[model samples]
Target chain A: MIDLRELYQEVILDHNRQPRNFRVPEHPQRQAEGYNPLCGDKITVYVHVDQGQIRDVSFKGAGCAISQASASLMTEAVLGKSLAEARSLFEGFHHLLTDEGSGPSTGGDLGKLEVFSGVREYPMRVKCATLAWHTLKSALEDESATVSTESPNPTPSGGP
Target chain B: MVKTEATLVAPSLDPGLLRPDFPALDQKIHGHPLVYLDNAATTQKPTAVLRALDRYYRRDCSNVHRGVHTLSQRSTASYESARGIVQRFLGSSSDREIVFVRGATEGINLVARSFLGPRLEPGDEVLVTAMEHHANIVPWQLVCKAAGARLRVLPMDDRGELRLEELGKVLTERTRLLAAVHVSNALGTVNPVEELVAAARQRGVPVLLDGAQAVPHKAVNVEALGCDFYVFSGHKAFGPTGIGVLWGRREHLETMEPYQGGGDMIVTVGFEGSTFREPPARFEAGTPNIAGAIGLGAALEYLEELGLPQIEAYEAELLSYATQRIGSLPGIRLIGTARRKAGVLSFVVEGVHPHDVGTILDQRGVAVRVGHHCAQPVMAHFGVPATVRASFAFYNTRFEVDALEQGLREVKEIFGP
Candidate 1:
């Protein structure tokens, strides 16, 4: 049996309780909306990119603990990083949550975002942990478009 | 409280005795005994239903109503007998009225496409309740859209009760048909469908009662309800998935065009055109789910043996007990508190998302539905994105409800301030 504590870690709970950057960034250059029609989870990601570097990142949404916390951690992790670096981080984060063989220690340089490593145990929640990341990725790629977890043709970057 | 004839003279139903009949119910998940409370989604099939499926597949495996072979004859008999069972179960006048479809969704689609779609005009309108499941709403929307007709909604109150007063205003001359959920799946509100059907009749409009959620909980007599059409899924009523019944008035069924065209639904095929079969066979285009229909017959027989009146009374008592037990908990707000409800209890925990609650409860082996329940409009009406719904069945017990309460307490503790 999987331990509940593994999935709902203390850091994840703390982030869910007091989500940082849980707001729309002022004068955002790129914005995108993400929705999981299955669970009614919605998240909007905003990024202000200046000279290929993420000047600011923030989000606002209503979702489960994993989704809200993931978004909160994402905003903090991606800030001040270049667009490519943020994309790499998203890739690593996605790998940690979905790849069954990969664990927190094996996932290279996930930093505090490693808290979502336990999400691999709950297959249903991987989408929850990835909703904001997908939205952020869409915001970076396209100017603005609504991204659903249930998108028929997922982006070439892959989707949950 | 809305009292039905079945609930008035009720016998006791012992869940303890009935529980063992369902093999799926007697199991453990994550070290705790599985407490399945997601009956509104689908029910666990009983041993009788399982045996019926096994027997049919093992002995009489043949296509229905096609060949002159002995096995085909036997399969056809069983399949048609299943329709007779459904006809008797719904108290419809003739077995000809029961047309088998994929499920309630397909059943509604048939009515929308075949019956109402051809008759609709540019200004015609179709009325649906706000609490309807997407199956009941989307089909009408499609038909109305194709015909350039308006789809009107009969609003429900915050308590999840239908505003019957609005029926007169919504049931205008332009209204071609009224499709409403006999019971709201999300809210558990047992709508006054009798009144709504009567009002639609007075307006000279046809009515289709979506009994997907209603048939599982209580006794439903379509003739008594006086509706033009009634539809329900077999899976939700402890039968097999992929099979359901569309019980329409013979007059309506005879006049409507076939929803699909295939071998079994035809009388004779020519190079120019093909004449269709009558009523149920005409609507059931392809080879139907013969085994599913047979299993559904066994399920209905099982329900009949137990008596729906007894099950209804037993479930009502259980619901009240659950309502009191779960409602008394702190920080738990019940989303749907309609005076007349079935076995559904939709609630939200303070400071905790329904998904989190569902996860926590699942850890403790309490299975529930945690989402919009395919009723987004109902959720929107309640101003909630999603809700944790614990729905009951005849085989569920107070012990299971207690387990739910304990699981919820754990959720509160883990997410508590």
Candidate 2:
């Protein structure tokens, strides 16, 4: 057993079990179905944008513990933030996952999301943890409407 | 009659027994027994195969077929003996019928390039099944594109089985080649190649079967199947990698040009022109994979001793048990449940991603393949996308099936039932 104290620390599993703003709003404006085709992970990210701010946010889908938990936590983090600020948060989180130099001021410390830092050691699971964040970005910026919760594009076998 | 402890007497392979055969299986992953269900991806080599590899390198290391020394002659004799064994294994009438290539991937490419590629004229059609591994499909696509021949795909039914009815409609006089899988890697659908071949022969169309997945699981007699060409990988059948067999009829071999040209294939190298050797030797260009061929030959000998029929029966029982157990699990959906199938169980848990399923199972020390399985078209056919595939070999047991079920239960617990 990968020590739960290390891998699925309470904060992470708590978010997974009872995600924040998990239900679709009674009246939502735009929705996109983001899919990660690799592992058949799907998340329907609903965005309620008003004026300049991403006022209300929610997600509904089936995914891994990391994916569901990260998505649940993402909605809580980005609520009431401006569209520009949400994109900035995405940059910070992306850096943490990719382990690029420009990680957050918290460094490798992912806060309540710290449990997922162990996932960096596992390059494959990094996607499971980041699947939601990718979809949220698509839902906010792209008008394509339906985003795929499918696994992020790995290097295609035959490079196009 | 079912075998019980007392009836079984010796009890055959034991918990501690089979464990020693696979070195990697002994190691703990997340504190559990490593149940290898990813045999379809590649099999873990047994002690016999490992030793064959070591013995080859340690004792009889020499370039084959051209050595004048005793060691060279021994190596050449053993190498040809290996080819002879492969020839017998496939029930080919002559040893010259077998051609050694890198692996199944290279074998398919060889046939596509040399045999089919040369003869295919403009407007001729090459028919391939939708359930084919990308190996079988992509190479032919390359041939068709270059030869100005059109590619026509034979669609699969909802169960992921080949649409045999639709096949009759497609096999026209224009159909110069008919290529299909003996067994589908992704779907586990065992295609009826004999019937397909019989129909294709009537139209004067040559048939090539992608028998990579089928060859390892059950008994195969190329003579019985009567296909023009049959290809399989040594690695998948518990042998060394970098080795595969491409068996063709003598007439076909004579007509087909060499796939590659370099050292061993040519008899003479004039400044202006070159003359090639005959048949199998002509096709086997460059310094051939001596060790791989030997290892594959040894692997066939092992299988012959084990009896393919016994392996098939044992695997079928395991497959049925796992299928039923997996079927009973709540929220579990088996992807390809064809009536005529091999021992592959592909599924998706409703609330859990396959990576999560894989990760959790990895924690439980159960290994399964999670991907499109290089059959994206089949994935598209199902419409649900990627699936977690638990492919079994003869070595697996019912206890492992129980463990898989337990792993799924844990998955249901993690994601919540």
Candidate 3:
């Protein structure tokens, strides 16, 4: 029996109810739109990068609790990290949610984002958990690129 | 505070007589009995339809319209007889008007390419309603693009019904064809298609009704509807997939060129040119889905035996029962509440995404279609990205509707305060 606990933890639910950084940053340096066509979950990630270090990041969108909470938690995790560190964190977070055979990298730096480790249980929702991260990746690489989960590989240049 | 199943099981619409005919209904999902409310997508096939498919492949499996062999003759007879069944089912004057296609999507594409494409000139408009499924919308758009014509959309009111008064504003002398859905798949709003057809006819504009969602729920007579073309998927009507009927006026079928050129469509092929078969055969290129057509014929037969009037009456009860049951739930806002609607309950729960609702409902073994439902314009009209659609079939019961209510409560509990 697949546990709903693995999909919707209290921490994730809390973030969903009261998401932080859930606004489009005013005077943002970079912004990109992420669209999940399957469930019509649309998230736009805005980042302010200063001297190769991530200064501030925010997102605004309508989506499922998992996606909204993931974005909320993601913005907090990548706020103070450098661009390179942010990219590594994205990779680690993505691996934790998608890489089923390999154990989750939730112990180290993911911290509050580790609440999403349970997302791996539902394969269909992996896209929801990663939608905000993809938009953030696109924002870091090209501010204008629209990231869609429909496109298997959207703009190869979308990573640090 | 949802009532338990024992308490909730009051006297209401039950599948009863027709439930046993469909084997798929008697199954378990996740650990609970499956309550399939996603009939808008596709219906569970009946035993008769399944048996027809098996009987065709086991006994009379051969390429249709050719060969002196016994099996070939039997296959050809069965295929042609299925066409006759479709003709009688639609109340079409002639069997020649019915052309077999992949599904409604392919049927619309065929008409758009063959009938409408050649006739359309630059600045000519194909008037479509806002509530059309992508099948009805995209094909016309493609034809319009190809023929240098504009695709004009007829607006819908807030209640999800088409603004009939606005139809005259859009229907001009330049309007070549009017394609609209008989029933909105996403909203369940039954369009006043007969009136719409009459209005279009007054302007000398031909009409095509996307009966994909209508045919299964209600009795659709193309002759009475007075539409130039009527298309529907077999799967949606309890038949097999990969088979659909496109019934067109005899005049249009004769005048329009074939959509595709292949072996069966053509009568004779020379180095210079090839002469095609008349009407139905002209459009049905290559070997058709022989088994699928036969199965569809059986499905039509099954529905006929059950009686459309009885099914319609029972389903109306189910729809109203579902509407009230689902609507009464806290934080659950019903999307489509048109004056006239079929058995579809589209809604959004407060503070819960439709996908989350779908997941929670799925865990409770109740199936429903969520998201834009291939009617993004309808979604745009409602100003919601998506909605959870619980569409009903005649086989659906009041008990199933109650189960949907209880499931929604579970969703509310998970996401509520």
Best by TM-score: 1
lDDT by residue (B12-131, candidate 3, tens digit) is 334777799899999988888899999998999999999999999999999998789999999999999999999999999999999999899999999999999999999999999999
lDDT of 2 by residue, B69-93 (tens): 9878877887899999899888899
RMSD of 1: 2.3
Please list all clashing residue pairs in model 3, or write none if there are none: none
Give the count of colliding residue pairs in each prediction. 0, 12, 0
Better of 1 and 2 by TM-score: 1
Winner by TM-score between candidate 3 and candidate 2: 3
**Residue B335 in model 2: shift from native, Å?**
1.7
Ranking by TM-score: 1, 3, 2
A12-130, model 2: which lDDT tens digit per residue? 76787788888888887766777666665678788888887999999998766678888888888888989987877776676666674443444433455445655655566777777
DockQ score, prediction 2: 0.35
DockQ for all candidate structures vs. native: 0.54, 0.35, 0.41
Location of the lowest summed lDDT over 10 successive residues in candidate 2 chain B? B1-10
On lDDT, who's better, 2 or 3?
Answer: 3
Best candidate per DockQ, number? Answer: 1
Superposed on all Cα atoms, model 2 deviates from the true structure by an RMSD in Å of: 5.0
